[model samples]
Target chain A: MEQARPQVDLEAALAASERRFRLLADQAPVIIWRAGPDKQCDWFNKPWLDFTGRTLEQELGYGWAEGIHPDDHARCLEIYTTAFAARERFTMDYRLRRHDGVYRWIRDNGAPYYDDDGSFLGYFGSGIDVTDHVETELSLRRALSQADQYDQQQKQAQWRQEMLIHELNHRVKNTLATIQSIAMQSFRAGVDVRSGLAKFEGRLVTLSRAHDVLTQSNWLAAPLDEIVQSGIEPFRTPEDDAFTIEGPPVCLPPKMALSLAMGIHELCTNALRFGALSARGGTVRIDWQVTGDGEGEQLELTWREAGGPPVHSPGQRGFGTRLIESGLAREFGGKVTLDFAPGGLVCRVHAPLPAEEPPLVGGLVVPHH
Target chain B: MGRRVLVVEDESLVALLLEDMLLELGFTVVDVASRLETGMSAAEQAAFDVAVLDVNLGGETRSFPIADLLRRRGIPFVFATGHDPSSLERTYPDAPVVRKPFLRGDLRNALARALAG
Candidate 1:
């Protein structure tokens, strides 16, 4: 009788404890949930309405899955089913649309409960909002990848600049070597030193000017008139008299422009030093004509120096003379002839210009005209 | 005399200097092809005891494309370059290289080493 009385008292105390726990759960902001062994929500605390903003009927059974984002609902359900079938705790975080239609992440945690016979009875669960934490993690990963890609691109640009520096150094050395040989031979032959130096400086400046024009297009090509003007512009003076340039605006390939510019430079320097362009009223007229089609096309150029002094042939064949005749001729694939008439100095150069590269998109891409 | 030779150099002075050295060595001079696309093809078409080739033509290194073709045809050709030897070593490791601004004897020795090796 004493043992049985103690047992009843213990049972009453346990019931009181259970009531207190349920009451506390009803007061909390987070929802306490219970489901049957069939995986259906059978009990929900008072806070369930506040969390889901649903009537009792809508908050019961599998109705809670309605608030989940459509994209995540199927995947969440699949995982939930797998966990439930394996009789394990199911915990997942996913977006659920609120009553205000704003999607927010939720952390849903639940553990399977069993009967005395070890058979599944139902489940005990709780849910909390975790949207801020999830968004922070994803945004952090994206920032890391962006920074990594930026570093890689910076490294590539640095390598490209180093290579360019090396190429520029090599090109400058070769230019100096050619110029040195010319100066040495001129000094050895006892040409007028001052005039020779002036000739050298003038030639270099012409070459430099042509290079500057091509550099604007990244060493690609410069227009025919651009090459001619740069070669003769320095001698053009203000006093209402300057060089005349008239040519078809054709872009010359790098090799042809380089050689032709140097050749033109030699002729202009000679004129500035002694020929038709030396005196006060000197002027040069330039023009070019292109004929044929495709790879067969050829360009004929005429440079006439007038209005200064009469033309006369140089006494000896100098480097400038050779360069004008041979260098331009070889590069141009045509002939160059000088007409040293008593009236003026005239030069005609002919060469086959390279074909232009095709456009990226096919067809005769006529611009909006 | 066992054989004759041909020299193909673009620089006129260098060509004259090479011709004088070849004559002193008792080898008959044949021909000189200065420009590319013509130089190596001239070699393949003609027969010479040994040929001296300049690797750069008008600032082009496509000289190797023709040289490689000549080597494949079983001609013993040597390279005489104003450029660096280490730069040419990658493509022409087995081919003999003589740097420019060389002495008269340097050409004869290089020609002999090329023929012998």
Candidate 2:
């Protein structure tokens, strides 16, 4: 009878302990759930019911799966079932609908439940809303990718700038070499030193003027008219019409323009000393035109003088003549003829015109001056 | 006669300067070609003991092709360039280089080094 009394008290105590546990779980902040050994949900805490806004009858069995986001349904079930079969603890994240019809990210921690006798009961789990945490992680990933893209762009720009500087350095060195060559020619042996110095200064000015035209166009291409005007600008006298220039709008590449300017300067200097420009009534006519098209394009320029002293071929080819012959020919990649007719000197130039602008190599961009 | 040499330069004034330098150094100028096409033919047909090549021609053209031709014929050559000297080392590692605006002695030394190697 004493043992029977203790057993009855024990049963009552066990029932009370279970009631306390259910009360605590219902009042807890987190959503708690329990499933039966048959893999069907049997009970949900008050918080869980409130979160889903569903009655216990509607939420029995697999009804809870209806609240899971469609995208996460398969994955969530796979994880849950896999852990259930193994009777092991598991953690997972999935989006679950709230009472307000908003999907909230939930981090659920689940563990297999066991009775004191080592008999398997089912599974119990708790979930917390972690939508803010998930969103912050996603935004952080996007920001990191954007920063990577900006870093790549900055690197490319820096590389381009370095290439431009390298190209600029190369060009400056070449210009220096050109100047050195001019100096050598101006001060060569067997020439009058004083006159040579004067010629050097004149040629320097001529080179500078050509550079001025090129600078305006960023050393890309220059107009034929601009080059001619720049060449003849220094030699213009009170007689503005002493030189009659006529030419169409012809654009020449940097190398061609430079050579043409130098050639024109040489012809003008000769005319100023011995050609038509030497006399009051003398007049020099400069005419140029583009002929043909495409691959056969050519630049035909003629320099003719009238009303000058009777022309005569020089006994020896001077520096000016040699430069006009060899330099112009090479630069033009065509013929340059000086005809010392009885009337005046006629310089004729024929050269092929490139079809398009040559592509700049290495650093293609020209840095602003 | 001094060592016969060919000059492949695009710029006329620069060509003249090179010719003058070769003459002053007591080398006979075999021929001078101002364009890459003419340069190619000269490299193939011209009879010369050595050659001086300008690295960059008029536009995008480079003298590397001519350099290769000279190499095949076992002819020694020197490269003159306005570009950084190290730039040429990548393509022609063993070739001698003379920077632009160079002294007469620089040309002579480069030529000597090319011929010796």
Candidate 3:
């Protein structure tokens, strides 16, 4: 009875120990293994064999190299060789062939083992798949570099184009000035229609003055001060302080500058030939003011002639009259009234200045960095 | 010293015209030079009763530098320009200006006004 009791207790202890080891290996996610000296595979868990899809005998010894990528075999072998010689741990990340013949990145870790006497014996290891993570990291780096290169190229192209445009504008301005100078000299050679020569020179001068404003403002909108001054430039005389100029500090857009220039030119020509600007001591007062209406915006301008010959409407709408009315009103989204006031000619122009915007040419917004 | 005047005009013809007009008005001509650089240089180095300047010279439209020099030297100058007066008036409110192709009397009047101011 006593002998039978001892046998039962031993059997119970053995069963409990076996169950604990099995639970540890089966429940754990990591694939684990053990081996003997001479790099022999003495033991491996179910997961190690399952991940490799190989039988125990097929994976014995260095047969596990079959799962290692062909390219990684030499480097991995060198690492293991060093470890075995030094009796140290061997751990690395490498591509391992999967069950389906595809290569996947795996976290491979192992440590050389020794007997109780410290002599080299064998090794054990764990592995985990990391193929997707490594691939994503590599692809992201490539995409980032490509974007950087494309942005750099676009910026360089934009700079070159701007320089070319500025150069072209400068050359055009110079040519126009030269033409005006030659024409004036030729007109002096023989003054047939002094009026006609004056008119031609006036136009060229207007264009030249406008170009000056554009250049000074750096191809941006022309200031109202500049436009008014430039318009009256060719007509100002020593004691002929005929035009009293006034306006708020406003920047006229390019389109508005052209139309307003032509209008001012007509006014100047008319003033010289007929209006208050025609006679000695004749004066023209010019002014503009801005005010916001219920709708959006409004500009009121007054061109009043103080001293001149008897005022009379030409009894016909010549280019000058129509120009002052229609041209000034066109696209102004506003109105204008020219009163041939018997005392002096008075022109009242009303326009709704458009809202200002950030400077940009064409569809591009200065191109983000 | 009769009203001595310095004429700084780029065009030789314009300069001669101004000189003749000044002589006729009993004013002695002190000097005449083209370009603002030389004009300012002359203004700095010489003493003058008054200066006459052509506003536009080889693309530079601003006479502020010459004006500054004259202002510092306490000498009055008038602008002789074919262009308009608004530009100059904005910069120099009290400075007198005489447009080109003028009557002999117009320059005389402008010179008198500038010297008086």
Model 1, A54-144: lDDT tens per residue? 7768868898889889999998889778988888898988787776788888888989998789988888888788888888988998998
Query: Model 3, A42-98: lDDT tens per residue?
Result: 776777778888887888888888788888988988887787667778787788776
Q: DockQ for each candidate?
A: 0.12, 0.58, 0.01
Off by over 4 Å in 2: A1-28, A31-104, A108-126, A316-328, A361-369, B34-38, B58-62, B83-94
- lDDT per residue for candidate 2 within A155-242, as digits (tens), equals 9789777777767777777788877877888898878999889878877888889888988877778899999887788788764578
Better of 1 and 2 by lDDT: 2
Better of 1 and 3 by lDDT: 3
Supply every candidate's count of residue pairs whose N, Cα or C atoms clash at under 3 angstroms: 0, 0, 4
- Sort candidate 1 into its docking category: incorrect
Ranked by DockQ, top first: 2, 1, 3
RMSD of each: 7.6, 4.5, 19.2
User: Over the full model, what C-alpha lDDT does candidate 3 score relative to the true structure?
Assistant: 0.71
Indicate the DockQ of the complex predicted as candidate 2: 0.58
Return the TM-score for each candidate structure.
0.68, 0.80, 0.43
Ranking by TM-score: 2, 1, 3
